[model samples]
Target chain A: MSHSFRVEATADRLPEANAGLDAWWSGAGLPDEARFAFELVLEEIFMNVVMHGSPPEGAPCMVDVILDRQGDGVVMEIADDGLPFDPLAMESPDTAAPMEDRRVGGLGVYLVREMMDTVHYRHSEGRNRLSVFKSIGST
Target chain B: MNVNIESTEGGVSVARAHGRLDFGASAEFQKALEGAVGAKPKALVIECSELEYVSSAGLRAFLVAARAAKAGGVGFAACALQPAVKEVFEVSGFSKIIDVQADLATALAALA
Candidate 1:
C-alpha cells in the first residue's frame, strides 16, 4: 500500500532501478509480460530525462518512483524536475513507415505509451509527474 | 547472455546467441558478427529465443551487421524469437529487410 521510493535520473542508476524493480516485481509475482512492460516504461522515462528533460548540455534530473500494488498490477508514479513538459501530450511516431523514413527521436516514448495500459502526465510546481500503470499476468 | 560460434555443414560458419541483445551486448555481438562475416561464412543465425530487450543502440548494431552481411554477400538471419524481442524488430521494421523466421529449422532452410 505504501511502497514509496525515489531515485535520481542518471544513466548509471538504470541498472540499479532495473534490479530493484525486478526484485519487487518477482516478489509480487508479476508476469513476464508485465515485467517487460515495466522495463520498457522505465527505459522511456529514463531516456526522456536524459535526452530531453535536462538542459541542452545536460543537468541532473531527479526521478522519484512510487510503486503501489493494484488489483492485478502495479502503478508507478514518476516525477522529474528538469523541465515542465507533458509526455502523454506528445504524438506517436509513425511505426507504419520504414526505419529510414521514420524520425529518429520520440519513438521510445511513443512505444512506451502504446505498450502501457495507462499513462498520465501532469506538470505541477515545476515538476513533471508521470503516472504509468500496467496489468500483469499471474506468474 | 551467451554466444557460441561453430561451423555449419560445408564449412559455413554459424554463430548462435542467447539472452537479451541490447546496448550491453553491442560489443560482443558486433565483434562476433564481424568475425563471422569476415571469415566469409555462408550464413549466420542469431537465435533470439532468450533475447528480451533491444534499444536503439542495439538496433544500430544490428543495422551495422545487416549492412556488413549485405556488403559481403553473406546470408544473415535470426530465428526462434521470443515475442518481446520480436516486437522490437517489428517496431523498427527490421523484420522486412533482415531475415527473420519463427524457428531455427526455417531459418537454416532459408539461409542454407
Candidate 2:
C-alpha cells in the first residue's frame, strides 16, 4: 500500500504533516517502533526545509511526502520545492564534543541518516527529494 | 508536547516534558527550556519520565537549552527517558555531552 500527502513549507504547519502521517499510520497498522522511526525522520526533514530551505521571498512552498509499504518495511520520500540543499552531503556534527562546544545545526540531518536503514538524496526539477527506508516488525 | 517547570528544593528547575517532542512541539519545547534556563537556577533538569519520543528538532532544543545553562553557569541534566527516546539521544550523541541520568532523583542529586 502507498500513501501520499503534502504540506505548506512553514514550521508552523508541521503539526499538519504529523497529523497526516498519524491518520495514515494508525490505519496502516504498523508496529510502534516503525511508526516512531517514520515520525522522527519526517519531523527532521520537514523542519529542516521549513527552517532553512530559503524559498523564494513571498512565494509559497510545499513539501510532498509519500510512503510505500515494501515487503516487511516502509519506504518514505520527502520532497520540497525550495532552495536546493542536499542534506545527505552535509557534514556530521561532532556528537562527542562537549556540551559547550557542540553545535546543533547539522544534528537533524545526521539523525535522519543514522535512524533510517537506507537514505538517498537527489535534486531534480528544482526540488530537493530525500528517500529513506526502514524495516518494521524487526529492529 | 507539554512542559511543566518545577522548582526542586535544591533550587534546580526541572522541566518535565510529556508526550512527543517533535517539530510540531519544538517551538514550545524550546521556549519552555529557555524559560527554565532564563531563571538562572543553579541547575536545570529535564525530567523525561513521561516523554515517549523526541525528534531531531526536539533534540536541538535540548542542546540549545544546555548551552544557555552553561553560559549562565547553571548545571544541566536530563533523566528518566523512555528507552526509545534514550536511543534517539544516544544515537545523536547527546548523551555524551549532557548528563543523562537514570531517574529524577538522581538528576536532582547531581544538580544538588
Candidate 3:
C-alpha cells in the first residue's frame, strides 16, 4: 500500500507533512522503532528541501511525499520542485567533536543516514528526488 | 512542545519538555533552555520523561543550550529520555558531549 501527499516548501508546512505520515502510519501497524526511524528521516529530508533546496528566484516550491509498504519494511520517496541538491553528498558533521568545538547544524542528514537502511538521491526533470527505506525488523 | 522550567531549592532548574521536539519547536525550545541558563542556576537538568520525540533540530537546541550553560558556568544534564530519543542522542554523539542520566533524581544528583 502507498500513501501520497504534497506540501509547500516552507518550515511552517512541516507539521502538516508530519501529520500526513503519522496518519498513514497509524494504520500501517509497523513496530515502534520503524515508526520512529520513518518519522525522523522524513523530517530530516523534508527540512533539507525547505531550508536548502528552495529556489533563489522566490518561486513557490512544492514537495511531494509518498510512503509505500514494501515487504515487511517501508519506503519513503520525497520529491521537491526546488534547487538541485543531493543531501547524501553533503559532508557528515564531526559527531565526535567536543561540545565547545561542535557546530550546531549539519547533524540532520547524518542522523537520516544512520537510521535508514538505504537512501538514494537523484535529480531529474527539474526535481530532486530522495528515497529512503528501512526494514521493520532491523530496528 | 511545552516546556516548564522551575528551580529547586538546591539551585537546580528543571525544565520539563513535553511532546515532539522537531524543527518547528527547536527555536522556541532553544530559547527556553537559554532562558533557564540565563537565570544563573547552579545547574540545569532537563526532565525528558514526557518528551515523546526529538529530531536533529531538537538536538541542535540541546547543543546550543549545553554550550550556553558551559559558557555561563552552569552545570547541565538530561534524564529519562524515551528510547527513540536516546537512540538519536547516541547516534549524534550527544551522549558523549552531554551528561545523561536514567532519571530526574540521578540527573540532579550528578549535577550536585
Best by DockQ: 3
lDDT of the structure predicted as candidate 2 = 0.87
Candidate that beats the other on lDDT, 2 or 3, i.e. the better one: 3
Model 2 CA lDDT for position B42: 89
True contacts kept of 3: 0.94
Cα lDDT of all candidates, in order? 0.72, 0.87, 0.91
Q: Which regions of candidate 1 fall more than 4 Å away from where they truly are?
A: A56-59, A85-91, A99-104, A137-139, B10-12
Stretches of candidate 2 above 4 Å error? A52-54
Better of 2 and 3 by DockQ: 3
Ranking by TM-score: 3, 2, 1
What candidate 3 gets wrong by more than 4 Å, as runs, is none
Compare candidates 1 and 2 on DockQ and give the better one: 2
CAPRI grade of model 2: medium
Judged by whole-model lDDT over C-alpha atoms, candidate 1 comes out at 0.72
Chain B TM-score for each model? 0.89, 0.97, 0.98
Q: How close is candidate 3 to the true structure, as a TM-score?
A: 0.96
- Model 3 per-residue lDDT tens digits across residues B91-110: 99999999999999988888
Which window of ten consecutive residues has the lowest lDDT sum in model 2 chain B?
A: B20-29
